[model samples]
Every structure is written in C-alpha cells, then in structure tokens.
Target: MRTTDVVRAAGGCVVRVGAAGLEVLLLHRVSPDEWRLPKGRVRPGEEPETAALREVREEAGVLAEILCPLDETEHQFTDRADSQRRTKRTIYFLMRPLSSTTAPTDPDFDQAVWLSPAEALARLTFDTERHVVGVALRLLLGQD
Candidate 1:
C-alpha cells in the first residue's frame, strides 16, 4: 500500500457584525481560481492556534484574535508538484477582527473580501471550508 503524507494546517474564520449582520473574510486564490478561507501549514514547533492567527493576518493583511476553537477538517488530495497523495488536517478557529484593512499581502491570493454568512457559504469552493465557516456563524449568532 502506498503511504499518504499527513500535513497539519490551520486557519481562522475572521468575522464581525457588519451592516449585513455576520460577515466572513475569504481569500480569492489566483492559482486555483477559487475562493478559500485564509489558511496555511502549521510551522514546526508552532501551535495550531498561533498558526491560524498568523495565517489570517498574513493572508488578509489584517490582525485578528482567536475567540474560540471552531473545528477541524481533514481531506486527501494529490499534490501537483510531486504527484504524491497527501492528507491535510486543518484546525480552524473563530476569530474577531482587530483591523479594518482588507488588502491581501499574500501573492497567491489577489482578493480578500468580507461577505455575509450565506454569501460566504455559497462562494467557498470547498465544502470543508464552508462547513468551518458555518460552524463559526452558528457560534457567533449563539446558535451553537
């Protein structure tokens, strides 16, 4: 049997109460041409929580603080560069935005925008990320 590499990643659902009620920050990735949550690999010796906050700041060009642990998702895919099967386990945190800027610093993504929960759910390319954001919305709205 071929072994699949396991990768640890973390991300945040940066949300705030906007005029439209609840809004979520999403990144528009250029390479895949898809909308995604701001996330990345957890660095060596770094905690998942810290990685999530860092990724949100780096990718969204805004600062945020974790309010609570949202949820985790795992999925498998083939790496394009190496043609190797890999499983990515991502930890997600519910975060509150600390800044107003929405410019994305990461070159991999060209756009960062805040959308309503329903809109974000519709715009997200992956079901896992959409689930994560859904959980965050429930918690924020005191439904969870």
Candidate 2:
C-alpha cells in the first residue's frame, strides 16, 4: 500500500428500535452512490468523539447520545484521476436517538432514512462501512 496521508474521520451507526427490532440511520446520495452513516473529516483540534456526534447531527438531523465505541475501520481510496491516494480510518460508535427530526442543516446528503440492520447491510455501499455497522449492531444486540 502506498502511504500518502492518513485522514482522521469519525462517525457511527445511529440506531433505534422499531417493530422490526433494530434499525440504523443512513444517509443516501445517488451521484456517488452513498448509503451509510453520517461521517466527516475531523477538524484540527477536534476530538473524534465530538466530531462523530457533530457530523451525525449535521448530516442526519437527529440528536443522538453515544452508547459506546463500536470500532475503527481503515480504508484506502484513489481519486477518479488516480492522482491522490489517501487512507481514512473512521471510528464508528453506537448511538441512540434522543429525538426524531431531520436537521440536515448542512445538507451533505440527498436523503436520510432509517432501516433495519439487515437492510442497512445490503444497502451500504462499502464493505468497511458494512463491517462497522455490523459491529455496532452486534454491540447493540449484545452479540459482539
């Protein structure tokens, strides 16, 4: 693997209980094919924990309280032109919604929806993201 830079990001699976058992919140975008949790780059002098919650509220419009840390996933991606190589490790967490409202004041995603963990697993676009969600789900289920 080529080492260009390491990026710090934080986000997590926001979960709630529904008739289906447990559901996770996911943000959707079509242009780049994204269907996963809200996450973003950690600003300078920012903690990953704080960044994760801020990104979640900014992208998903819901106020959530963190339950615990899920796991961190490292993924590498190259720009379409293959000019930039970067690796990002996102720290995922398990959170519970404190309120229900689409606050998307930042408008980073096209749409946001809550889906069962199984549905989220199938709809997620990246394997690493799926793994993160799976870990969070099992933690939520006491199976982890």
Best by lDDT: 1
TM-score of 2: 0.88
lDDT per model, in order? Answer: 0.90, 0.83
Residues 123-142, model 1: lDDT tens digits: 99999998998898778778
In angstroms, what RMSD does candidate 1 have relative to the true structure? 1.8
Tell me each candidate's TM-score: 0.93, 0.88
Tens digits of lDDT, candidate 2, 1-144: 544477789996899998878888989965677787889888989999899999888888888888988889888767455657788888988889998766566654778888988899999998888988888877767795
**Model 1 spans with C-alpha error above 4 angstroms:** 1-4
